[model samples]
Target: MKLNVAALLALSVPCFAQQDPNAVEAGRLVFRMSCAGCHGLHATGGRGGPDLTRGTYSTGDADKDLFSVISNGVPGTEMPSFRGALEDANISRLVAYVRSLSHAGAVPVKGDRTAGEKLFWGKGSCGQCHRVGMRGTAIGPDLTRAGKQRSLAYLRESVVAPDADLTPGYATIVVVTRDGAKITGVEKGFDNFSARLIDLSGRYYSFLKDDVKSMEREYRSVMPSNYGRMFSANDLDDLLAYLASLGGER
Candidate 1:
């Protein structure tokens, strides 16, 4: 499943001229239209997607692996197959653009990571919902590999405006049973026929729409949106530094 020698050459060349300049540009445009939502504008990752600019991927690092994942999508994940949506040539161009991103270095973060760690567990109370490296609750997205899976800009926005880009399954849900009992928790699953939720205490519940009086899915995040006001500028920088330091080579 190797790409042609020309494509492989383009990966090593600065201009990628061997693959044709037009193809690289086309791939950049295609990525912006199709892949940027999850992978970030710079292919650094967004909305829980893994960073592709790191020259490594969870799906495998071969050119064939990238092509296969794009064409066939990963099961049990948000990535969707583009086999029907894009032509083979377009997919190749995308690969070219993605490879180009590896030439760029990661942006440096500011603030003290130690201070940020303190804020995460103490002042921020972030551990109450978010988990990092086997600690904290599972109510929110795990930060165990946050450094590798999200862009710094995306992480900054998440702390101040969580609802701006909601994660797939962490939305808020409210349900009222037939007996007048109300339940509110993070949505675990939802469909036309059924809904599942997990409360703060890590309790899970499922209900059939027919059996419940009402079920409301709030397409916004359950994470607090007041961190911007709560933390000082330095504190925010410290937090970002700590987050950026997570999941890197130990």
Candidate 2:
């Protein structure tokens, strides 16, 4: 079932983040007693729980959503409410503790982030397809928050095998115009009437379905699949590390 994220976002924000130092510690203790079973001992996530440290949430990530998810629980998922078990004040501390996990001071990386950024824009030509921040093209997935959402293993797999897994809303499109002009790129939007394609160079191409001689939807990803062979192992690791740190600092 889909969650009412709109309602979740409309809830009031919690204030535990402004509490005394003891409250954060108290929240940690509460987490161990109440949440660790499913979220994991360190809140790294396990089984049904998602990694709190990644800072990605399906429900909302605002302070209000954090408080609501715990106080009222989600409607369609295994996440349960703590309204009767714990007071609102305690839920605030839990929110504080959860937010602390994503701070750079808490989670550190082993690889060189600087080197990784260099490779991603330089030799990798990633910007040509994937957009990072306000720059790059939209022919591929946006990596601006990749570090905050995807795991290290998942990032590694994506680089090694571009077509191994495809994110939703980002399928490939091959268009053959009536004039015999062929174009291939990532599909952004389409219908029986017309289609939009963001080509490799970040150029946008729109054509009416009837005007094109033929249009084929390809399951293959537009991203190059030779990164595992392109970069040295260490370079690849650094690149992943850099990519992983994109949305983490703030």
- Model 1: worst 10 consecutive residues (lDDT sum): 9-18
Model 1: CA > 4 A from native? 1-37, 48-106, 248-250
Per-residue CA lDDT of model 2 for 81-158, tens digit only, reads 899898677788798888878773544456798999999889998888877888777667777767655556567778
TM-score of 2: 0.61
**Local accuracy by lDDT, each model:** 0.81, 0.76
Please list the residue runs of candidate 2 whose C-alpha ends up more than 4 Å from where it truly belongs after superposition.
1-50, 53-108, 248-250
lDDT comparing candidate 1 with the true structure:
0.81
Q: What is the C-alpha RMSD of each candidate to the true structure, in Å?
A: 6.4, 9.6
Can you write out model 1's per-residue Cα lDDT over 1-250, one digit (the tens) per residue?
3236455434544322325655667677789899988887878777656677767666677667788889999765677899989877778778777777776775557789999999999999999998897789988888887876677778899899999878777899999999999998999899898999998778899999999999999988878889999999999999998997786344
lDDT of 1 at 74: 76
Instruction: Identify the candidate with maximal lDDT.
Output: 1
* Shift in Å, residue 113, candidate 2: 0.9
